[model samples]
Target chain A: MSADRLIKLELSKLNVHLPERRPSLREALSSARPQVVARDGSTHAFKREELEFLAGLLPEADRDKLQLPILIALEPKLGRGTARISGEAEVKVVSQVLEKEASAGELLIYRPEVAILRKKLPTTTQYLFLW
Target chain B: MAALAVSPTRMELLKLRQRVGLAQRGHDLLKEKMDALVIEFFEVLRRIQEARMKALEQLSVAHRALSMCFAIVGTLETKQASKETRRELQVEISTRHIMGIAVPAVEVREVERNALVRGYGLHMTSSVLDEASREFERALKLLIELAELEGSAFALARELEKTKRRVNALEYILIPRLKEALKFIMMRLDEMERENFSRLKRIKAMLEERG
Candidate 1:
């Protein structure tokens, strides 16, 4: 029973580091100090270099549509290591960065690919658990 | 193999199934965290390498400048200049999270200061001494950056090891054990039902024979 509670607690904490309200790419780029407040109330800052790299990937109009810290969703149903990236702007940027063909609104990447994406966009990408 | 001690009942089975589910979920999320941590750790390490190189080079330069100052103005005078100069440096240490782990983000005040801000007596401050001070100040800034990077790296590494351990326990111990116990209970329940059915048939046959 204690073990059950611990596992449940761990699961609950899996996504708590995620921001309650993620700062938009435009907001982050324009602000003097770009950061988001997590659900746990801790702040996460976006590096200026990462923001600039993200800006280079999209046109000015898409900056607002493109959220900062783009979430790479991991669902058990997707299998152990596969993750998905949704949102049109997010798909565009991820597909381009990974050099994969651009899909419409969603992109599915495997574990190794996810690692590469995280490596390239540390400040701009985060892992989000689903299901 | 580590079957949890429980009766072979439906209630225990239900609870065990739930535990397995929770374990699997925790394992998956922690694995993800581990992967993210690896990326973060490597990034810090790479930055540390660059910072280490720069800082080391600057330190050597500072040492050379100091040696020259020692030769130009006797050793005692150079030592006196260093004593009078401002030596207090405070790092503004805060934290940022990476996959739920709070790694530190340190900011140091402007380390490279002008001669006047260095707080050395102007009359006693020779050009050689100024040169040495300038080099050392630049080296200090680089060193501070290196320290921040190294600190973050160590924190990330510690968290990574912890997450990896949890993932391994779920994968190799808890989940497999729960599944094994679940199988054992299901098999026992099936065998019990079959034995009960056979006994009822035998009793009916005896009754028919007696009639």
Candidate 2:
């Protein structure tokens, strides 16, 4: 029973670093100090240069559609070395970045592609683990 | 092949099964955490490589600038300028959580100050000295970032190795042993139930014969 309790505690802690609310691209670009509050109440700030780079990647109209700290869903069901980028704007941006045809509302990227995306958008991207 | 210290009962079997389930789930989650740590570690390593190259180059340039100062302003004057200059470089180090582990996140303030802010005295300041200071400041900034990256890589790797060990324990040891024990209990329970039925039948036959 104690082992069960410990496992539950470990499972609960997997996503504590996730932000309670993500800032939009426009908000991050405009603000001098743009940060998100994690579920555990820690602050994660976006680098200004990364923000500027993201702003350049999207058009003005699409700025609001794009969110800060893009969720990279890493699910075991997707098999190893694969992640899904959901949300319409997220799929669009990721597809363009990877030079792949854009899908509607979701896109799956391989490990190397994920590495490239993270390299290009370090502070702007955050990994989300899914069961 | 040590036996589990539990009676061969359905209740014990169920408990063992639940434990195996928990262990399996923990293993998968920890595995995912390990994979993510590897990615994060490699990313840090890539960044560190670039930062190291830039920092090392700038450092060599700074050294060259210092040598030039030594020749132009004389060795003692350059050494004196170095002494007068502010050398305390402070890095903003805060803890950032990577999964359950906390790694340091370091930020550096604007280290490359103008000659006036270098505060080596107005009269003693020279172009060569300022150049050396500026280059060294830039190098210091890059090195600070590099240090943070290296620290994170090591921390992540340590966490990754730890998680991997847990996963292997469950996958290769705990889960399999639990399953084997469960199988042994089930077999023993079945054998006992069969023996009980046979004993009951034998008693019934003797009683009927006596009657």
Candidate 3:
């Protein structure tokens, strides 16, 4: 029972770093200090440079559609070293950054590509773990 | 292997299954965290490599400029100018989370100051001194960046190690043990059911023989 309790605690702590509410790109760009508070009550600020870079990649109309701290979902079911980028705007921005083709609303990127993407946009992207 | 001590009952079996499930889930999720941390660690390292190179190069350049200043403007004068120059440079530091681990985010605002702001009087200050001051300022800025990157790399590496240990514990120890206990309980339950079946059959045969 204690082991079960420990596992439950571990599971709960896993996603505490994730933001409570992710701001849209439009909201973040318009604000002077673009930041989001995590579930753990810590503030994470987005670098204006990275935000501007992401802004340039999308059309003005799609700016609102894009979300800050874009989730690169890593699900075990998707296989190791593979991550999924969902949402039309997110997939588009990520694919454009990696110079890969985005099919449908979801994009599957490999480890190398994820590295490159994270490198290019460190503050604007976050890793999301999915069971 | 030594498994957990639990009664070989259906309820205990179900609880064991749940524990195994939780353990497996924890292992997989922690493994994912570990992998992400590795990616983060390498990224920080790659950034550190670039930052270190740039910082070192700037530092050498700054040193060369200082030596030139020392030669042209006289070492004693340059040292006096350095002492007179303002040294109160503030770096804004805050915490940022990368997957539950806090790493420092440092912001150096306006490290490069001009000749007038360098606060040394114009009478004694020469172009050489100003040049040296600017180069050193640049070097300081780069060094600050390098420090931030290095700090992030260390924090990420530590988190990665911790996560890796948890993943291994689950993979190599906890999950396996839970699974072993699971298997033991299922086998025992099956054996008990078989024994009960045989006992019932014998009772029926004996009753029929008496009748």
DockQ for candidate 2, C-alpha atoms: 0.47
Ranking by TM-score: 1, 3, 2
Per-residue lDDT of B61-156 in model 2, one digit per residue for the tens? 989998998999899988888888777767789987665467889889999999987789788878998898888888888888888888888898
Model 1, span B123-172: residue lDDT tens? 77688888998899899889988988888889888988888888898899
Proportion of native contacts found in each model? 0.58, 0.40, 0.76
**Best-fitting candidate, scored by lDDT:** 3
Off by over 4 Å in 3: B68-81, B120-127
When 1 and 3 are scored with TM-score, the better candidate is 1
List residue ranges in candidate 2 displaced over 4 A: A23-32, A48-68, B88-90, B200-211
The iRMS of model 2 comes to 2.0
**CA displacement after TM-score superposition, residue A60 of candidate 1 (Å):** 3.3
- The A-chain TM-scores of all the candidates are 0.96, 0.92, 0.95
Q: Cα deviation of B78 in candidate 1 (Å)?
A: 1.4
lDDT for position B128 in model 1 = 89
User: Per-residue alpha-carbon lDDT of model 3 for A33-120, expressed as tens digits?
Assistant: 9999988898888999998998899999999999879999988778877899999999999999999987889999988888888889
Best first by DockQ, ranked: 3, 1, 2
Angstrom error of the Cα, residue B183, model 2: value is 1.7
